[model samples]
Target: MSNDAVTPGETRFYQGEGQTQPLFRIEPGINCQFAREQASELMGYAQDLVLDGLLERKHNMIWAAHYLNALAKALLDDAELGLAKAKAL
Candidate 1:
């Protein structure tokens, strides 16, 4: 946690990040597809916001999309490994 937010395509546990509940928790289970859908919805919202010229909140939506998709990927990766080493987000 170097005063920087967690970026997409990353799964680093900051010094104090794991002490609190994660903003988004993607479990390695049947809910993965739903997580993907939610990520897509976030992307759509980001796109729509940009189209409407709403610049302020668009980045939030886009960031949500990125991280949600990343979490979904992590979930699937854990499932692929037989869930033995799956972390609970």
Candidate 2:
């Protein structure tokens, strides 16, 4: 799909032939921006959790670390996508 032609809130899905399963649409625009921002903020919280020795408390550390790593990867992917979009423009 052309980048500029993409609607800000349109939902697109992929499906295999003969499959009746529903497809999930990627969040667009402000919603996506908010989600990414929240992820980033959560990552910071995870760091704090680890730094404050909260890791030993009810396995919060493990959960925090996992989320931090996942968010980092996602953020990197988003950055790359953004860079590509900019270049495409």
Question: Candidate 2 lDDT (Cα, whole model)?
Answer: 0.52
lDDT of 2 by residue, 1-89 (tens): 23332224333343556766535433444234454566678778777777665635657676667656565445544444554454577
lDDT string, candidate 1, 15-74, tens digits: 234466445433433343444455566566645655554456556655555554455455
TM-score (all chains, Cα) for each model: 0.34, 0.44
For model 2, where is the 10-residue window of minimal lDDT? 1-10
**Candidate maximizing lDDT:** 2
How many clashing pairs per prediction, in order? 0, 0
RMSD of 2: 7.8
Clashing pairs in 2: none
Give lDDT: candidate 1, residue 24.
48
